[model samples]
Target: MSDTAQAAPPDAGAPPRTGHWKLIGPGIVAAATGVGAGDLVATLIAGSRFGYALLWAAVVGCIVKIALAEGSARYHLATGSTILDGWRSLGRWTSWYFGIYILIWGFVYGATAMSATALPLAALFPFLPLWAWAMIAGLVSAAFVALNRYEVFETVMKLLIGVMFVIVVAVAIMVLPNVGAALRGLIPTVPAGSAIYTLGLIGGVGGTITMAAYGYWVNAKGWRSPAWMGIMRLDNRVAYAVTGIFVVAMLIIGAELLYTAQIALTEGDRGLLDLREVLADRFGPTVATIFLVGFFATAMSSILGVWQGVSLLFADFVRNIRGGTESREELTTSPAFRFYLFWLTIPPMALLAFGRPFGLVVVYGALGAFFMPFLAITLIWLLNSSRVPKEWRNGWLSNTLLGGAALLFIVLSIAEIARLITG
Candidate 1:
């Protein structure tokens, strides 16, 4: 064969292929982080309350994620800047909002992630008290982030994802309902007693502040052009689809296994731990063990991901604010980056000592509810304007989806605020 024939076809007369799978990075990491413990609990509650009637919300969540992830990736590909840079182009106000948001969000989320990880460890091995296990969880995640390079971080996360994938998806398959009912979930009708949780599940489906980190992941993967956009979309789609499946599986467990069982799982992550005992009772110890392992994988991955990913964001934020002419590469590797990483891991340990403040949890949720809408609205403005090249700007479809996400997020945010205030 000629050299040209052997080299594989080029994309739009650009460089020849090395392969596609090698390009998958940010989408996987962002999607993984977005589907954290809180998200899982949302799906579980939806399942327990309404069975598969609200499954459409989970599907809607997947769509919202794709829109948000694509918007972030689009900014990077079009403008050759981080979303932070894009925000800077808009004005200092954008940067200020993110700065305040990250500071408050990180403090509260650190404690929440640590506690979620600790709950399972305390369950799996009662040798340690919950607070001690929580502290250990924080330290272990800190070590994982501090010790590993990006490639190693990605590998470990993929492994954790695999554990979650096999167990949760397998359980879903094992308890497969009639195909008709599952397919009917796609029609988008709200079931009785499902208005709030349905909205919650839709909002929860793979949504998180980590969605902003998708652009950075793309930068890490070396996908930096309009040419790679198709593959980028595919990557986001596949990642979030897998995320949706895991969520739906948890919902199925709630619906099929726990709904009518007369057991009231506790609030927050303690509820998930309680659900494990319910699993043990209903499906035997092996299934319960599977639940525990899956829970730990979900929690630990979220911790490691937030520890590394948000630290990168924080480093960039600080560098941008400091304005000392640092490059992205240097910003990520700088002392400042490591400092924020340490900050994310350590100071929250104070919360572990005193027990988490209920006020902070409500603030976290209330503040968190606004993030998706914030990201969505910002991307619509950034990616659509002169900040990016015309070739890489969001097409009509991307805009429509993002606009829909913004609207959905607004409604969800109001609902969340009402719940927080009322509770």
Candidate 2:
């Protein structure tokens, strides 16, 4: 029991780890990326159209995301592999499917993201054309990604997240009405014309292809072991916890303010610009301007995160498929990574020149429809197998939650496809 008998010291080669607040990396990025322009528009459209009847859908969406994101993080911490590599171990076809999915997703998403970011900018600075503002957003996102390290990127995103919750939620609080009806939304019933929006909200809550990037952020932050699982859970919870509050605030604004006024919010990101008009009428131009600023922050944060995070995933995909697994140094320093990063930034700007990229836009929505189910199904496979150590794999409860997410997203996707096909 002597000090000398206190045993050999911990291994010098062991990895360093983060604790508590510093464990905040991936969760913040994932949350910021998830609550983009599409989410805002969807919630506002629901509010303007259906009042508070679909409020439960937004809350449910947030919960589903928490489960899905935690699964991604668990897979990373348990197996020490990116989801791309995890998919590859399942089969070569898995990699090919992801490659095609991401390629199409990114091309369309870049244009959509740029346009969303530009709406606020154009509103604020009318001198610049919308396309000009769009280019600036794309370039600004590219510059930030090119120059900043992961820590810097995360810090900036955290700040934008702070601004969004403060301004947007504060506005919602200022606008809440009919506490009785707002509470009734918790009953989980869908009104007429609300079924599609309800499913979209449920499936869209804080999700995107970037959810898979949770692991890279974990690795970037050095959160590398099973002991860190509790911390990972807390991080994911707090992230979507903030996201849930944000969506609820949007719903309140929609139901209390927009429904009462009988104002219709347009579909897509322009709906946020539309909200500016509604806010101006109710609360004055100052509040309207504040909302625009928040909208800009939301759009910009997602663009920057995708510019950096997804490009990393793309780079890894290339590395895995081409049999360069041993080249970690090259993977980080490779031309493939830079190429995808450029691809994410550049081509979509051309859409600004020839009007909006309608085809890209359509594909973005379709890709989005299937993404949550894809993530849920893949996480179920990855975490419930020998790929992850038995001790760290999903428990029955986790599997059940993920399975529910899969079903929910599948239903949502079917509805979306029907809308597209019929339209």
Clashing pairs in 1: none
Task: For residues 21-61, write the lDDT of model 1, one tens digit per residue.
Answer: 66665677887777777777777777777767777788888
| Model 1 spans with C-alpha error above 4 angstroms | 1-18, 260-263, 358-362
- TM-score of predicted structure 1: 0.92
| Per-residue error (Å), model 1, residue 26 | 2.5
Model 2 segments beyond 4 Å from truth?
1-19, 326-332, 356-365
Instruction: Tell how far residue 45 is off in model 2, in angstroms.
Output: 1.8
